[model samples]
Structures are given as C-alpha cells and as structure tokens.
Target: MRATEHWPVVVIGGGQAGLAMSHELKERAVSHVIFEKNRIAHSWRTQRWDAFCLVTPNWQCRLPGHHYPGKEPHGFMPKDEIVSYIEDYAKKIDAPVREGVAVKKLSRNGSGYRVETQEGTVTADQVVLAVSAYHKPKIPALANDLSASIKQIHSSEYRNPGQLPEGAVMVVGSGQSGCQIAEDLHLAGRKVHLVVGSAPRCPRVYRGRDAVDWLDDLGQYDLPVDKHPLKDGVRGKANHYLTGRDGGRDIDLRRFALEGMILHGRLLGLEDGRLVFGDDLTKNLDAADAVYNGICTMIDKHIESQGIEAPGQAHYRPVWQPEIGAESFDSVQAGITSIVWATGFTSDWSWVDLPVFENNYPKHERGITPEPGLYVVGLPWLYTWGSGRFVGVGRDAAYIADHVADVSREKTAVPVASRKETRPWHGLDGYNLASAVA
Candidate 1:
C-alpha cells in the first residue's frame, strides 16, 4: 500500500481564492499543499466565453500582494488577460499546488481529516475548501424535454454566435450571462429572443463615472454580509445585468427590445412543441429599470451629501413596452434553432460528509466552520460583499490564515511523544505528530 502524504494544511482549490489562501499560509510559514482539479484559473480559461471580460474595473484586481499591473486601471481586463493575471500571481506566490488532482471525498479521521484524491489519499490537520459555490451549471429539468435538433447549451459552454446553427437564437434567463450572450448574438446580426428574469440591472457608467467606482466610494463593498440589508439572503440574489464589453456600457434590455430583439417573461417550460412563458415581460423590465434608477438615485444622494463636483444626469425612460406578448410560441415556427440556458450555477457539497451544511450551503462564520479545522472560502457574502471577489478575497483569506495559525500553535504546544503516530509532520522540527490525533 502507498504511504499517505501529510501536510499541516491542505487547500482544495486553485482559483484566486485558493491562491490567496496559499499566499497567506506561506506568509505565516505554514507548510501546506493545494490540490487543484485542473490548472490554476481553470474556470476562467475554459468556462468563460471568448469575448468575456471583467464586469468590474481592473483596479479591483487586488489578490494579496498582487495588484493590476496594466496601464488602464479603469478599463476591464479581457478573458486572456484575466487568466494571465491569475497565472502570474500563482508564480509570484510560489504556491505549492498539485494540479489535476481531483479530491473525491473529505471525511473526518480522528481529530484531523482525510482527503481522498484521484491520485492518492492525504491527511491534513486543517483543510480549506476555497472552491466557490458555482460547482455545477444549473439547467432546468425541462431542458431534457427539448428536441435534440434544437442544439441547446449552457452559458458556460457557449463560445460565440458562429458556433451555433444559422437561425434565430432563444436565450433563457436575463441575468448577467444571459443578457451579455444575447447582446453578443444580436450584435452578430442574429435574431435574438430573450427570456427576461427578475434579475436587476445596473448602469455600467453613470453621471460621468463608473457605477462600481461610485459604489466603492460609498463603502458598499466594505459592508459585511450580516450587516447587509438582505443579510444572508443577498447571496441568493442574481447579479445585476450589465456588460464591460466594447469599452463598457449599460445593457439596456429596453433598448434591445426597441432594436428588434424579442423579449419574453420567465421561461415556463415547453409544451406541444411550443415554448411557454409568463406574462411578466413588462413587470420584469420595469423591475430592472427601477433598480437602474434606484442606483442612480442612491448615487445622486451620495453626490449631494458629499458635495462632490461631478456631472449630473437625468433618469432613464422606457424606450419600448411589450403589448401583451404571446404566452406561448412555436420555437420552430419562430426560426429559433438554438437555446442558450444562461441560468447560473450551483455547488455540489455531497462529497463533504460533515454536519456543517444548512440547505446545501456550508454553515460558517466567515470562513471558519462549526467543525474545527474545516473551513470554507470563496463564497459570495462569506464575510463582506467583496468576500468572493478579487477586491475582498485576500482579506478573507488573511482572516482564515490567522485562525489556522492559532490552531497550528495549539497543536505544536502538545508534546510530540504524547501524540499518536500516523504521519510525520515533515519539515517542522522533526515532530512525528500523528495524523489521527484525537
């Protein structure tokens, strides 16, 4: 039998969150290993569309010691540049990562933990699951009912308009990806039909400044999840629909409607060779506009209260309105040959056989779980609004590292001879600390 490898700490991801955690662990001289299912920034490299770019500005690319090095701090980084930034950070931090090692299961082993990977089993005193909640692409069960010739795909698999068959495309879900992909297809001169959801919308730029900058200045990003208006409920909210493509601009679905794109209400599954939809097209559009205007109103208040000299702008008006859209339509008759389900994603935590979950979400205060030495990170609103983004993940990682260091110190205080024998604590003063210490 192969001997089980051991580490003081093991991180189970290689994205920005995992990399940031590794950087913090190294800062405290904590010996650890990072097991990556694929290469660093794998999702950014493979999942994103070809024209994808950061919705936030480049300046917010703060990952521990690394910051955006490009000249255009205000501009957005494209897909390739974003991947390069992550790769460079990994190199700069000198993170100890084992690529292509997919962790199969994580279960308790005495007081420590056991990590069974595709390559081998490893034991660690502490494990940090830095994998974000977006583990699996979520598609409605009704998608299985679609005709096979219709050529359906999730947003993650969509590359460009050219990849789809030559026909009008129907994109379901008007979240960030949904709206953006719809625009991408529409810009390519393909007739687009969009199913609008309740997801809100935000202006890319407002009153002569980026909305993100205004929000950052308003200290919105620093607000903790608990202190947020929605509290934990904020995590379930869909991201505001907007785009940074083509120098960044507002994604006005209303404007798109006027420009010949057909808009519908929420997708209500298919029946009798026709797509059914709710009569909430106008409602959804109005809700999105209300949010767009609400943000402008908030920024306006901030400007007035602070007496900042900035440009003034008027509120938006609806460019078009749906006049009782058909509740159902024959997609084949409408020439809709492709369906893009830009429906978001969900995490799969079934492998984690622990009592640390509530309603599929890992129960934790910040990153520390109720189970000692088991933690989670890279989750939206884990601590602050920035907890999962580049602007905030480093701080979250630092906080978790401090706690991990405290746990390490407590273990080190116990005499080596008093502990059970399992795996040697390599490169740490010749301590033969058992991996199964209780």
Candidate 2:
C-alpha cells in the first residue's frame, strides 16, 4: 500500500462508461480524477476485427446531455469511427482522464476508497468502477487437446484471418462476436465453420419500422432499471445469447452461413484436433426453451410482484422470445484444423482487491456497492431493461453517477458503517438465485 498525500474522486477505466462518469461529475462541479489502464477506447481499437461496426444505431450513441453530431444519426458507426467519437467526446467534455494509469488494488479507508495504481496511490471520497465488459477473452478449455500445429485464438486476440495458416477455420459461439468474426473470415475467402452454441433470432425490422426506431418510439431505451434483470446478468453469464441491436444490416457471416458455412453443434471437447458436440438439435432446443421460459416467467412474476407496469401493449407476450433455443446437435465432428473461440468475456477484477463482489460479481445496486462510496458501471445487466450492456451502459453510467453524487454530497460525518455492506446482504442464497436466474 503506497500512500498518497492527496486524494481525488477516482473513476476507474477510460472507456465510454468511465467517460460518462467524468462528464457527469464535471456537470455537478465535482473534482475528480479518472485512471485509465490503457488509451481511451483502446479495447474497441484493438479488440474488434477490422470490419467491425456498432450494432446499435448512431442515434442511440448519446451520453447524458451530449448527442452525436452527425447526419447519419440512425446508421451504425464503424470501429474507427466509434473510437474517434470517444476521443472527441473526451476532448469536448474535458474529462479528467489520466491515460496509462492502471489501478492495481482498491480498499476501504476511513470515509472513502484508497486506490493503488502503478503510477501511485490516490484516495477518493468516492470511486467508480467503469471497466467495460469483455475484459478477458474466453477460450475453450478443450483447446489444449488439439495438435500444436493447429492455431487457436480468442476473438479478443484476433485482428484478421489473413494472419491464420492457410486452411479452413472453425469459429465457435454464435453470439454477436462469433457471428461477426465468422462472417469476416468467410468474406475474406476462407472456408469457415461456425459452431452454433446459442442464438437469439432478432427481427431485422419491427412492424415496417426499423427495430431501433420501434425501441425508441416505445421508450424501451427509457424504461427504468429493475424491469429486465436477466439482461443485467448477461455481462457475467456464460451461455447468454447476443441480441443484435443493428437491424437489417446484412453482414457477411449471415450470408456466408446461408451459403457455404457448415454449422456444427456446441464445441464439447477436442481429441486429436477434432472438436465434439452433442448431435441432437431438437433435444437441445427443448432444453433451451424450458430455460428461456423459466426466465421469462420469473421476470413476469417479478414485475407483477413489484407492481411495475408493462411498458406498452408491445410488452412481453408469449411470442416475444428474445432468444432462439439452440437446436439439438448431439454428436461430434472431426477435421478441425483450427478453432476460434468468440464465446465472450469475463471480469478482470484480479487487480481490484475488494469485498464488493461474490465470485467476481459486484454486490451492488445499480452500481452502488456495499462498500460505501464505491460504485460500478458497465456491467452486463446492472439494473434492468437491458441497461448495463453496450447500448445501455451510458444511461446506466448516468444513474450510477447520480447515486454516487448523492452519497458524496452527504459526505459530511456519516460514519462509513452506516452504509450497507452488499456482500453479506446478498449471501450465498441470494448469489445462487441470481446466478441461476441470470
């Protein structure tokens, strides 16, 4: 524990969420410092493939009071454009972000948080954890069984398939990352195999209008948190499907899969460079349907219990299944030359030493941890109505910042013990229910 003489209202991460926190703090005239592990939006700059674009429309890109100034407001922005937007946003708002300063550990100290970083230690009356989702790439455990001659990489490490050895490549996971990367490889003129794990069949358009337009019109984006808890958990849950916000944007993956892409079952295991999976698609679909219905029913019960009104007539009906159950494929396949696991990510809180999480998940409410003055943003589903993921993170950040500000203003003499400790509140039982439901 290196000690610093002075303290800052510290904000962790320099991604969109962190920037949003800093922006909000500036508006409220709060003095703060943001510690960024790398360059701003470096994940987007480095993680996504070359052809990657925003799944949601540009109109939904606004953060708090700032709207994206562009003619193509409804169009999806590309990776570079998004990076540029964040860069420009930082400049425009003058966020106090210090790049290359990675916080190594954080702990409770007196009335605030003491953050230990590579640069030095800084204390703050409050702390905001804005580290984005997808911090660590998830590679399959069975990958080691494959021959060393075969190449394997998580989507995080993949820049282009052109770097791969000349042969057919197998991409595992059917979520947004997997689909997009598989599409890119296929269009790049390589034989591609996509291993279908789980998928959500999204309507390219809703009732003759773009899906995003419908979402905006229905105020789906404006729906308060606590309405969609399942979505809140996607940032952490492994088997969750990716729901594309981009409507009718034909990517090469969909086209190629329809053409020559060989679809396989979930990647179960590998033997002698051969990947295996169950061969029964129907049975798999049945199991997925049961789980999906269970979640939906649980959510409906929660809504009814809380007296939360359904947003509209377009409110969840039996037909509004956001995900398609994985069709059963109960057999294994051979001849896997290479495997690309685009399965998604997990939290990299290894450097964050705190008692705010149960199994690495923050024990908090809409980003407020049990640890007083410590908060979080950019979780999978922090509150409700799909607020913590990509399209929802900005609003979530705003809400969290509001709560943090509230706590800060009352910073006068309220002993830290007065605040709730979330860890014990959501004990093992609560954690089990949350993990299962999420």
Candidate 3:
C-alpha cells in the first residue's frame, strides 16, 4: 500500500508563486505544504542564462515579508542575488517545503484534490496551481523541416554563446530574451542575425531615473488587463525588447542593427532554401516605436499635471539601422549555422488532469478557479501586467490565501472567536483572516 498524507491545502511549484501561496496559508494558520520539483526558487537557479538579470529594479521585489532592504534598490537584482533572497526566505518563514517532490498526477479526489507524486500521495481540501506561467519552451513546428546540422536551441536551454556551434546565429523573436541572447552572441565574436518581431523597445532609464518609476508612480503596474486599452499597448501585454544587461542597461534594436546585426522581419516559414517573412519590417518597427512613445507620452502628461519639474531626458527618434531591407532572406546564403528560438514559453498541463484551461492557458479570474478549492497564480495579466512578475505574486498570494481560508472554513465549523479573529499574522505580510473570511 502507498503512503497517503493529507494537508488542508497543497501548493504546487515552489517558485515565487508557490512560496507566496505558502506565505498566505501560513498567515491564515492553514495547514498547508509546498511540493517543489527541485529546491526553492528552482527556475532562478537553473533556467536563467549566465548574463541574465531582472529587468525590474530591486525595489519592486517586495515578496511576502522577504523585502529587499538592501542598499541598491534601483539596481537590477542578479540571478544569484534573487536565489539567495528566496532561499533565505524559505528558511526564515519555515515554509513546509518538500524538495525533489515531482508531482506526477494531480486529479480530483472525493471533494478535494489528490496529488500523486514520486514520494507518495497527498490529499488536500484546496489546491493552488502556482507552478508559474512559463513551463514548456515554445518552439515552432516548422523547426522540424530544417536540417539537424543547423543547431537550434530554445532560450531556456541557452546559457552563453560558447555553448553554441560556430558560425552566424539567427536569433528568432525580438523580445528581451531574444535581443539579449543576440547581443551576447555578437559580443562573443559570432556573427548574429536578429529576426526582429513585434516587440517594442523601452529605455531602461528616463529622466535620470528608471522608466519603471514613471509607470509605477502612474499606477500602470497595478492596472488590470480588462481596464487597459488593447491598441498600441501590447507592449504591456507581451514581452518588451529591453534589457537589464550590464547592471540594468538599455538595449535598443535599431542600435543593435547599426552594429552589424542582420535584421529581418517576422519569420513566416521555411521556403525553398530560405526563411519567408511578410513585407512588414518597417511597419513592425514603426509599431514598436509607437509603443515606446505612447508610454513616454503618458508619463510626460502625468508629470506635467502634477506640476513637477522633472530631470531633462532626451527623447529618441528611431532611424532604421542601414535601413531595413526586403522581408525574405536566404537562411543558407546568410551563413546562419544556428537558430535561437527566443519566441516564448507556455504551460504544460499534461500532469494536471483538469478541465480548467482556456485559450491553451489555465483559466482563472484573479487567481480564483471556477472549481471551488482550486486556484491559480503567476500568470501574465492575471490582474495586471505585473501579475506574473516577481513583485506581483504577493498580492495574488494573499488573495489565494483568503480563498483557501474561506474554503477551509466552509469544510469545517468555524468558532465564533476564530471568525472574529483580526490578527492572522504569522510573520508574513500581515494579512488578517477576518478581513478575507468576512
């Protein structure tokens, strides 16, 4: 017979999201445990590239009680620094985290959830799918037709250019990861071909301060996706071409092109001996510029309205580096020996035996699952554009905790004293069960 354990709530995937859920459960005095595939903050430890740093500043990483009290609030935190913070947090909070527990199956039990892992089984009244937003590396199906001789690797597997095969590299997609990898390859003396996409560029700093400051001050970071306009604002919706490279330095694509990167339009598909593209390189570039300008305009207006004399920052007008050429390119003629797919990543729901997906993503409203006792977090645009970011998980975590407390109360008779309890603080972010329970 297999060992069967039970918990009031079981939080899956001990990244920022799962740890956040743990903090919330801890605050509510909820009996919960975190099941991590690896150690705490596993992705930060393994998934990131060698030169990767958070694009956001240090001040934004206000996790549940594990605040960034370091001196460099504005500087971007490196991968190691982030890992250390999370590791320390997991130890300090005493999060009941079971490491190396790979959950093979998560299905519905009688009225709860059954987590079948390599260690054993766990039944929980409530379940949190905080496995993070990105799980599987997204590679286009067209990659199969290309000869295996041309090395291809997703952004997740890529570390440094030295790991790649010799010759010119074609970096598909122009988001932050793609752009950064292209830069890395170019700097390493490898000829790089950057296939620019619809990604917009935002300067790391503006007005002697970070651009994030203006957006955060304007409450843009907290704005819900439903409340936001759809057009010219996709920058906030998807990944943007910006970098925290070299301690939060800006990376402009047009500037990248000026320095010998062979830029191309959106990748259509593989053709006779070349990769096809739509004749939209200039159009896409214009759209990207529009996104950058739109944000600046909003910030400028906010500053003017507040009668604030801000520091002088130079506004930029984009000039096509060597003037973008025709759309299609001969992949073989360009001597592109390798391809880096920085397109994106998606969630893998094979382990999750549930009917909760919509648009190929786990469907939830504010992290609340339609199925009672089920919840999700760490998805982009969950409530705001920052929903999936390091700074945003705490808010969603608190919400999930409240729901868990409510569900737990429903499953059991709540005492009058417990119902009226105001202080639910267990050394986390000081949340009370009474507020959420009511």
Candidate 4:
C-alpha cells in the first residue's frame, strides 16, 4: 500500500479563488497545495468565447496582491488577456499548484480530510473547495428531442460564427452568456433567433460612469447574502445581461429585435417536429427593461443624494415589440441550422462524500460549513454579491485562510486524544461527529 501524503491545508482548484487562497495561506506560513485538474486559469482559456470580455471594468480585477496593471483601468480585458492576468497572479504568488490532478473523492479522515486525486491520496487538516458552482453545462432535456442535424452545441463549445454550419442560429436562454453569444452571432451578420428568458439587463454605462462604478459607490457589492432581501435565494438568480465587447456597451435585446433578430419566449420543448415557445416574449422583454431602468433609477438617486455633478440620463424606451409570436415553428423551415444552448450550468458535488449539501446546494455560513475543517469558496453569493467575482473572491479567500489558521492553532495547542474530550466537535443533523473524529 502507498503511504498517503499529508499537508496542513489543501485547496482543490487553481482558478483565481484557489490562487488567492494560496497567497493568504502562504502569508500566514500555512503549508498547503492547490490541486488543479487542468492548468491555472483553464476555464478562462478554454470555456469562454473568442470575443468574451469582462462586463465589469479592468480595475475590478483585484486578486490578492495583484490588481489590473494595464493602462486602461476602466477598459475590460478580453478573454486571452484575462487568462494572462490569472496566470501572472499564479506566478507572482508562487502557488503550489499540481496541474492535471483531478480530485476524485473528498471524505472525512480522522478530524481532517482524505483528498483522493489522480496523482495520489493526501490527508489535510483543512480542505478548501475553491471550484466555483459552474461544474457541468446544463442543457435542457428537450435538447435530446431536437433533430441531431440541427447541430446543437452548448455555449461553452461555441467559438465564432464561422465554426457553425451555414444558416440561422437559434440561441436559447437570455442570461449573460446567451445575450452575449446572440450578439456575437448577430454582429457576424448571421440570422439569429433568440429565446428570451426572465434574466434581467443592466446598462453598460450610466450617468457618465460605468453602472458597476455607481453600484460600487452605492455599497451594493458589499451587501452580504444574509442581509440580502432574497437571502440565499439570490445565488440562483441569473446574472443581468450586458456586454463588455468593443470597450463596453449595453446589450439591448429590444434593439436586437428591431434590427431583424427574431425574439421568442421561453423554450417549452419540441412538439411534432417543431420548436414550441411560450407567449411570454413581451413579458420577458418588459421585465428586462424594468431592471435596466431600475438600475438607472438607483444610480440617479445616488448621484442626487451624494450631490455629485454627473451627466443626466434618460430611462430606456423599448424600440420594438413582438405581435403575438408563433407558439411553435419548424426550425428547419425557419433556417435555424444551428442551436446554441446558453442555458447556464449545474453544480456536481458527488465526489464530496459528506452530508454538507441540502438539495444539491452546499449549506454554509460564508465559506465555513458544518463540517468544521471543510470549507467552500468561490461560490456565487457565498457572502456578498462580489463573493464569486474577482472584485470579491480575494476577500472571501482571506477570511477562509484566517479560519484555517485558527483551526491549525487549535490543533497544535491540543493533543488529538484530548481534543475529543475537551473540545467535543458537534455535528449537524445529517453528519456523524463520531465517524468524522475517528
């Protein structure tokens, strides 16, 4: 039998979150390793479209000690540049990352964790799951029913217009990815059919500054999930649609509709060789516009309240409206030769053999779970709106590192046998403390 290696802390990811955690752990002199299935910044390099860029400005690229160093503080970095930024941060921190080592299982091992990776098993006093929630691309079940000749592809696989078969492209879901991908196809002069969802929209620039800048000033990003009106429910909300392409600009679905883009409602499924859609196209569009104007209204109030001299702005006015859209259309007749499912992703935590999840969602107060030494970071709305983004992941990482350090101190101060008697660690409802400690 191979002897299991051990470390004080083990982080399972090599993205910005894991790198940030490594930096903080190193600062505190905590010996650790980051296990990445692929190379650092793999998602940014492989998953994103060619023209993809940050919707938020480059200044928000604050990952630990590294911040955006380019001349354009407000300009958004394209896909390649974003990858370089993360790679540069990894080099700067000297993070102990083991590339191509996929973690197969994570289970309790005598008051610590047993992380089974492809490379080998390792025991760690603390484990931080820095992998973000987007683990698997979520395509609807209806997709399987669609004719295979339609050339279906998830938004992650989509690269450019030239890659698809010649004909119109139907994009389903209207979240950030769906909207942006639709725009990418439209700009390429491809006939585009978009299935709009309830995802909200935000203006790229408002009141002579980016909407994000105003939101930052308004203390929106700092608002914690616990204090949020929806509480943890905010995590499930689709991100507001906008674009950072070509400097930055608003993604006006209404304008796209006006400019010959066929807009449909929610994808109901396939019916008798035809694609069925709901009649909520107008409703969805109106809801998106409401959010766009709502942000503008909020920014307008902030400017007035702060007595700041900013340019005035008018609320968005819908330039187009659908008139009783068809309930179902033959995709073949409509010339939609390709379909892009921009429908988000789902979390897969099956490898984590612990009872820390409730209904597929990890239950935690920030990154600290009921499983004492097990922590999760880089999750959407982990604490605040910025918890998962570059603007906020470093702060979350720092907090987790501090907790890990404290736990290390406790373990060092107390002997293993005495820890059970003096510090009796209680388990949550579904967890077994005795087994965890054993």
Stretches > 4 Å off in candidate 3: 231-236, 321-327, 411-438
Give Cα-based local distance difference scores for all models: 0.86, 0.64, 0.76, 0.86
- TM for every model, in the order presented, reads 0.93, 0.77, 0.89, 0.93
RMSD score of candidate 2 (Å): 7.7
Cand. 1 TM to true fold: 0.93
Better of 2 and 4 by TM-score: 4
What digit string (tens of lDDT, one per residue) describes model 1 on residues 1-438?
Answer: 144788899999999999999999999999999999999999999998988999999999999999999899999999999999999999999999889999999999899999999888989899999999998999999888877779899999999999999999999999999999999998999999999999988889999999999878766666666655577888898878898898899999988988899999999878897889998999889888888888888788778877999988998899888997649988888898999999999889998988999999999987889998998988988877788899989888887887798798884423323533122112221111111010
RMSD of each: 9.9, 7.7, 6.7, 8.1
- Which candidate, 3 or 4, has the higher lDDT? 4
Q: What digit string (tens of lDDT, one per residue) describes model 2 on residues 10-124?
A: 8888888888888878776778888898999899899887777776667777775567778888677888888998898899889888899888888877877778888777788
Model 1 segments more than 4 A misplaced: 411-438
TM-score of candidate 4 on Cα atoms, chains taken together? 0.93
- Report the lDDT tens digits of candidate 3 across residue range 394-425: 88788667768977877553432344312121
lDDT for each residue of candidate 4 in 228-344, tens digit (9 for 90 to 100) = 667787788888889888999999998998898999999898889888899899988988888888778777766776699998878899988889765998998988899999998
